[model samples]
Target: MTAPESGDVWSFDYLWRWQHERGETEGRKPRPTALVACVKGANGRTNLFILPITKTRPSDDRLAVEIPQIERVRAGLAADLRLWVMIDEYNHDFLETSFYLDPKGRIGRFSSAFHKAVLAAFVQAGREKRLRKVPRYD
Candidate 1:
């Protein structure tokens, strides 16, 4: 729990941008989230960025990557359940001190190759300047 690696998947309260825009401070429930990055800010606190995974198929307007069947198993999710990781947006939280992230909530991890693919797509999303970020901490 001290150091969050990029491929790690965990049950997290991932707040969406729309929810925050509506003045919602916390996520509705803890769901599977993909750890994208962990950065140390100037103040020395580690910032955790994550993408939410959902079973609902993304709309045409949204950008998402489907979790491969093998990778799904690697992540400890139901092998038969179709899931996608939304790359167009991400949830930001404090890794050093967070009320939403619990150590016991950790699931399995995606393979390095899969994580790399997701990261690549995420970086592409960033380049497009359409990535919506929802900051969970004040």
Candidate 2:
């Protein structure tokens, strides 16, 4: 199982290519960011991040394509991520627009309350593990 290059944003096609070459079964889901937990990708559930090739890199210093969203949200390391079932309501509008961590530290993306719940659950689980301690974002 090959992991994406650190600090690099990956396009859908590129990610699919990697999956194909590696015989992975994790398909692209309708999420704002292209990270998912697959029952058959590397592990049962893995932290994978993907961004389109067009807006891959936004930082002037970094020439590589990396999503600034990840940095803002303070997601835990791969070993610290929690796997939660993605409900249809939570998935709505997730892929249509980009998400950001607001000044209040709450997830600011889609307008779906369900999605917010899912993200909150993930954060809570990670906190319990103490693997990734994001500052209070209540």
In the range 10-110, model 1's lDDT, one tens digit per residue, is: 99988988998999999998899999887889999988889999999999999999999999999999899999999999998888778889878789899
Task: Locate the minimum summed-lDDT window of 10 residues in model 2.
Answer: 87-96
lDDT of 2 by residue, 67-109 (tens): 2344324432122333223211111112212232112321223
The RMSD (Cα, Å) of candidate 1 is: 1.1
Model 2 scores a TM of 0.20
**Model 1, backbone clash pairs (residues 3+ apart or across chains), number:** 0
TM-scores of all candidate predictions against the true structure: 0.95, 0.20
Over all chains combined, what TM-score does candidate 1 have? 0.95
Q: Which candidate is the best by lDDT?
A: 1
Supply candidate 2's per-residue lDDT for 80: 30
